[model samples]
Target: MSIWICRACGAHSESRSGPPPKCSICDDERQFVPEGGQEWIARETLASTHSNDWTELEPNLISIGVSPAIGIGQRALLVLSSHGNVLWDCVPVLDRKTRDRILELGGIKAICLSHPHFYTGMVEWSEALGGVPILLPQADLVYVTRTSEHIRPWLGDRYEVLPGITLHRLGGHFEGSCVLEWEAGAEQNGALLVGDTIQVVPAKGWVSFMYSFPNLIPLPAREVRRIASRVADIRFDRIYGAWKEKVISSKARESVARSAERYIRRLES
Candidate 1:
C-alpha cells in the first residue's frame, strides 16, 4: 500500500493497494477532472520523474517549483526568518535532491498551507525533513485527503508560526484559505505570500479573489468584502501569488482594497 496523489491537483489520498475510485478534489466545482478522466500516481513515481527548482524571490525568501510543472503548477515559497525557515505552500513531488538542497540552506521548521489544493505531499515532506509541524487551518479539515500525525490544526483567524511570520485566513477561494505575511520580507516593508486566495493577476499591482479560478467562477461580493476587510490593515508592500512571476512589487495593501471594490462593483452592477 502506498499513498496515491492526484495528477491534476496534486492532493494526496490514503494508502491502498490501488488508486482510489476518484479524486474528490478534481470532481469538485473549484477544480476539474482532466478530459481524459481521473489519473493517479504514487509518490515514488512522481519523485522519479519530477524535480524541484528553487529561485530566490527576495533576501530570505525562495520559490520552489517542480520542473515540467506538476499539478496546478504553483510554486511554493520558503521564508527564512530568524526563528526558522517556513515553507508556505507545497508541491506534489519531494525528491532527494530537493530535500538536500533545502537542508543545505536551512532545514524547514514548519509547513503551512494556504488551502486544500496545495496540501499535496505535506505528510511526506514533514517526514522527509524530520517530522516538522504541519499547521493546517481547522476550517478546511474536511478537505484533508491524506491524514497524518504531523498535522496541527490551527483554530481562529490568525496563527503565528514563527517570530515574524503569520498566517491569516481570508476565506475566499476556500473557507480556510489563508495567506502568509512575512514581516521582514520585501526589504522590511513586509510581503504577503497569497496562494490563490488573493491571486496576483497578470496586470501588475492588481489582484483577484475567486471561489474557482479555473472554472472562471467569481466569489460572492460579501465574501470578497470580508476577505478584503480581513487583510485591509495588513502592511504589506509586496504580494506573491501561487504561480511564478505573479507578484505585486509595491502598494499591495491598497491594491487588495482597490481590487475588492472593483470586484464587488462589477458583480453588483
Candidate 2:
C-alpha cells in the first residue's frame, strides 16, 4: 500500500493498488478538482523532487513550506516552546532533511491542525517525529481520510495544548475550525495562527471569512459575527494565515473586528 496525495488539495489517501478514483476533499463544495481531473502523486516521488523551505517568522516561530508550491501551497509553523515544540499546521511534503532539521530543534511534542484542508500527511509527520500526537477537531473527523494511532480528536470551543498555547474553535470555515493562540508570541503581545478560519486578506491590516475560498462562496453574516466573537477576547498582535506572506502584522484584533463589521454590512446591504 502507498499513500497517494491529491495534486489539487494535498490531502492524503491510502490505497492498496493505485490512487483513489477521486479525492473526496477536492470533490467537496469548498474545494475544486482541477480541470485536468483528480491527479495523484506518490509520496516517494514528491520527496525526491520537492523540499521544504524554512523561514523564521519570529524568535520562536518558524515557517515551513514546500518549495515549488505543491498541494494548496500552505506553510506550517513550527512553534518552539520550553514545554515542547508544536507544529501548528502540516504540509504535503516531508523529506529527510526537513525531518532532520526539526529533530535538531527538539522534535515535535504535538501536531496541531487548524482544519481538515491542511491535514496533508499528518500521520506521516507524527510517525516521522517520534509518533507525536496529532490533535484534530472531533467535529471535522469525517474529512480525515488517513488514520493513525497518534491521531487525537479534541472537542469543545477551547483546548489548551500547553500552559500558554491554546486552541480556540471559531466555526466558520468548518464546523470545528480552530486557531492557535500563542500567548508568548509577537514579543509577548501574542500571536494567533489562523489557517483561513479567519483569512488574512490581500488588503493591508484586514482579514476575511469565507465558507469556500476557491469557489468564492461566502459565510453567513451570523457565522462571520460568531467567528469574530470567538476571538474577541483573545490577546494577539499578529495573525498568521496559511499561505506565505499572508498576515496581519499588528492591530490584528481590531482589524478582525472591523473586517467582520464590514462583511456583515455588505451581506446586509
Candidate 3:
C-alpha cells in the first residue's frame, strides 16, 4: 500500500493496493488533466526528488511551497496566532527539512484548507505534525480521497481556529471554498489568506472571483455579489492569494469591493 499523488492537481489518494485509476480532482472542471493522461507518483519518491521552500511573508506568517512546481503549484501559509499556529492551505511535499523547520517555529496547532485542490498530502501532514486536527469544511467532504481520524469537519459559514484567526466560507471556486482571516497579520490591521476563492489578479490593488480558473469560466453576477457581500464586513488591509507575490498590500477590503463592482459591470456590459 502506498499514497499516490496526482501529478496534475497535487491531490493525494490512499490505495490499499496500487495507484487509483484516475484523479477526481484533475478530472473536475475547475481543474484539468494533462494531454498525456493521468500520472501518479508515490509519496516517497516525491519527498526524495522535491523539497519545500519557506518564506516569511510577515512577522507570524510564512509561505511554504514545493520546488520544481508539482501539481497546481500553490503555496501554503503558516499562521502564527496567539493561541497556536495554524497552517492555512497545504502543498504536496513534506520532508525532514520541512518538518524540522516548522517544528522550530513553535509548531502548528491546526491545519485549515481553502478548498479541495490544495488538499494535497494533508493526511500525511497531520500524522507527521503531532497528529494535529485538520479543520475541513463539511460541504467539500466528498472531494477527500484520503481519509483520516484526525480530520474534524465543520459546518456553517465560519470557524475560529485560534484567538484572532478564523476561516470564512465564501463559496466561489467550490461550495466549501473559504479564506483565512488573521487579526494579527498586516501589523494588526488584519489579513485575508484567500486561495483562488478570491484571486489576487496580476492587477495591483484588485482581486477577482472564478468558477473555473484554469478553464476560464466566470462566476455568475449573483454569486460574485454574494461573495462580495459575505466579506463586506471583514476588516482586512491586506489579501494574500495562493501563489507567491500575490498580495494586495493596502486597502484590501476596499479593493475587493471595488474589484467586484468592476467585474460585475464588465459582465453586465
> Model 3's lDDT to the true fold?
0.92
User: Superposing all C-alpha atoms, what RMSD in Å does each candidate have to the true structure?
Assistant: 1.0, 0.7, 0.9
Candidate 3 residue lDDT tens string, 1-269: 68999999989999898899999998888889899999999988988899999899999888999998999999999998668899989998888888988888778999999999999988888988889899999999999988999999999999988889999999988999999999989999999999888999887898999999889999999999999999997888999999997899989999999999999999999
Ranking by TM-score: 2, 3, 1
- TM-score of predicted structure 2: 0.99
Q: Which whole-number lDDT from 0 to 100 does residue 89 have in model 3?
A: 94
Q: Which residues of candidate 3, in runs, are more than 4 Å off?
A: none
Candidate 2 residue spans exceeding 4 A from truth:
none
Tens-digit lDDT track for model 2 on 1-269?
79998989999999999999988899999999999998999988888889989999889999999988998999999999999999999999888898999999899988999989999989999988889999988999899979888989998999999888999989888998999999999899999999999899888999999999999999999999888888899999999999887988889999999999999999999
| Best candidate according to TM-score | 2
Count of backbone clashes for each model?
A: 0, 0, 0
